[model samples]
Target chain A: MSDVFLGITNGVLYGLIALSLVIVWRSTSILNFAQGAMAMFAAYLGMTMSSHGLNFWACFAIALAAGFALGGLTERVLVRPLYKRPEINSIVVMVGFLGLLESAAAAIWSTAPRTLESPFSQIYFEHHSTTISLSPFALFQIISALVIMTAVGAIFRYTNLGLQLRAAALAPEVARLLGVRVNRLLTFGWMLSSAAGVVAAVVISSSGSIGLSPTIMDGFFVYGFIAAAIGGLESPVGAVVAGLLIGLVQQFLQDYAPSGISSFAPVIILVVALMIRPQGLFSTTKARRV
Target chain B: MISIANLSVSFGAVHALTNVSFDAAKGKITAILGANGAGKTTLLRTITGLEEAASGEISLEGTSLLNMRTEDIARAGVGHVPEGRGVIAEFTVLENLRLGSLAAKVNFQDGLAEQFELFPVLGERRSQHAATLSGGERQMLAMARALIAKPSVLLLDEPSLGLAPLVTAEMMATISQLCEKQSLTVLLVEQNAKSALKVAHDAVVLHLGNVVAAASAQEVASDERLRQYYLGLVDQ
Candidate 1:
């Protein structure tokens, strides 16, 4: 029961990361390899502030703001110029950005791993006899991720700005004809996506499962990427569902599979998913009109 | 009023529009008649600021639109229905209409009944995906989406592209009615010269990226030489 609860909480964090990937992919049609690195940089910046006696909440907010700025700047400076060029150009640039970000983070903060502090306690809720594995901190993480995801969904579905974002993603030229400031909307997508990355990073760090280091999100990135791919890369809701399923399978592997081979489980699942439905589980099978 | 003076647009070495200038009068349908590759679409795109002019001036209500972005031009009261309808196929009819209102920042707090009144079939299929809409229905939806913005200047490209002859006539009639009722300034680009000349007050005929003729619709419609040479109109 404890393992299952922990798995679900962890999966929610992975879902958040996958959601970030989906956001950028749907808008720019580019897989942002530097997203995890950007999140790491933001988390480290928040840690630096917290070390300087700032409260956890303030540091968290600052981290999100830093992530937003980093995302917007990256899109404007690194991505925008290469937008009209081949897809390979953007992919190469993002991979290069990932390397630069990781190196810069290591230079600023030592390569040594550190634990991120949590606002909530890690002790389990005391219910007579049955011990639930979910700590207060874990519960808070799950709730926060769910709430944020719901809010993001609402923004994309209900708001006027959301309408512009969707239009910009699907048909930028058409959106432009309709008076949508497409460039601005694309920048907003990056900002929102980076902020989501910050939430996932903070969640993972607080749980002490991965700890904080420049390379901490490397594994998470792989898992999140696979989840996004399985979710059809375009649907945020699909990404989250895939993330949760991946989390469950991962937990089972950790419990039942050998220690050395458990890490390969995600790859196996990804292969299977690709073979079964390459377009993704959530993607609509749209017929080619032309 | 929209004015273009000495406008020229080139793609690489290929000039799409060369030294073209024309006026679409206030509250009038000005049709652009030409065959394929005649720069009809290019002319409309240039007016909407989607295509940058190499050397010319486009002024709407006396304000220069040469350096403005597409969105800014749209806000300046220009609504464009691009070639192929340009409807976001994934979006529902209602959502597409909402996107139109968002363009000009016009609030339809009173529901989209006004759009429904304009295109009754769109109202019935408001919740359905635009992909499911017939070609004629999609065209009407595209027009409604643009008109919902209440734009003073509307640019339509190939509105009669794939519709049945009867449907094309009905659509053209609706466009004419809108021009009279709302006093819309319309720039209609069409390959169907016969249908266009029937509703348009003025006509600009293009051939090989050049404005070959600019006259009142009736004059171009009556001139057998001009009609046959540029408009593909053979005397009936």
Candidate 2:
């Protein structure tokens, strides 16, 4: 029961990161390998703000804004010039960007890990003289993830901007022919994606067990990517569900199985998912007409 | 009106279009007929700013269209339905229509109503993905997408490429009706010279990237040597 609660909490965090990845991937068709590093940078921004005596909410807002600016600048400066180039060029560039962001963070803040204080109490809630595994901070994480996911989903589904974003992604030439400013939308997509990543990073760093470091998000990114793949890279709903499933699996394995074996959950599940459903579990198969 | 003067395009050593020139008069259908590599598609693409002109003037009314971005050209009221209809297969009919309306900044409800009246099949399948639409229906949707913006000029590339003979005739009829009703300056590229000439007010025939003939559609259609050599319309 405790494992279930823990899994749900961790799953939502992973889902947030996966959601960020999905937003950028769907809009631009580029898997940003630098997403984790960007999130780390944003988390550091929040930590720095908190150090300066800013409130938790203010720091969170500033981190998201910073993420938005960083994402837009990256798209304009780095990605735009390589749009007509080969796919491998963008992939290699993102990988290079990941390294650059990590090094920049390390140079500015040092390589040492720093603890992030959670706004809510991390102590377990007591019920009938027995302490449950759930904490106020954990509850906050779950609610925040759900709210953000719902809002993002609504934005993509309901708004005119969302319709244009999907069109720009699916058929840019067609979108441009219709007068959509696809280049601007691509930059905006990156902004939304990075903001989502900042949310994931801040929440995860606020966990008692985790600390803010340049490399801390590396493991989360791997898990988030696996969730994105399993859920179908094109489906946001799939990403959250898959993230939760992965969290549950990891929690169960950690509690019951041999300690070392739990670390291999992502790899084993990813291989199994690929073998079973390479197109993703949630993706609808359609014969695309060119 | 859309005007093209001394338009030239090149890819490395291959000249796709060289000194091609024509004017598609307002409220008229100007059929650009040629063989597969006759640069018909390239002309439309260049006019829409998809391909940069090496040296030429392309203008909508009196404004130069060269050196402008594709989206800017679109916003400037040059609607192009490129080869393959250029519809997003993943989107539903309504969603595709809504995307088209975004550029015009028109009220979506009004645009949707107008397009539905024009292409009734799209209204019927408004919720179905465009991938499921038949070839003829997809062509109509593409036309509606361009029309939703209410552009002054429309550039259509091979709208009748894959339709049946009956469907092709119907599509051509619709294009003719649209040009007359909306006073649209239409530059239509087609491989089907016979059908294109039937509805076109004027014709510009291209052979190997050069305009071989520019005359009334009737004169071009009636010419024996031009039909035999360029149009592939060997007499029965």
**What is the per-residue lDDT of model 2 for residues A165-268, given as tens digits with 9 covering 90 to 100?**
87888788888888889999999999999999899888877877887788888888989998988888878898889989998999999999999777788778
- Candidate 2 lDDT over residue span B1-236, tens digit each: 88889999998899999998888898999999999999999888888878888998988888999988999999999899999998888889988888888878888899889889888999999999998999999999999989998988999999999999999999999999998899998888999999999999999999889999999999999999889999989888
Q: Where does model 1 sit among the CAPRI classes?
A: medium
- Pull out the clashing pairs in model 2: none
Question: Judged by DockQ cut-offs, is candidate 2 incorrect, acceptable, medium or high?
Answer: high
Find the number of clashing residue pairs for candidate 1: 0
Highest DockQ scorer: 2
Off by over 4 Å in 2: A285-290
DockQ of each: 0.77, 0.81
Supply candidate 1's per-residue lDDT for B155.
93
Off by over 4 Å in 1: A285-290, B109-111
Error of 2 at A71 (Å): 0.7
Tens digit of lDDT per residue, candidate 1, span A1-290?
Answer: 77788788878877888989988987777899888999989988887888888887887888899999999999899988987898889889999999999999899898988777888998887788778888889888889888878888788878888888989988999899888999999999999999999988877766665678998887888888988888878778888888888888888789888885657777887889777877787866342120
Residue pairs with backbone atoms closer than 3 Å in model 1 (clashes): none
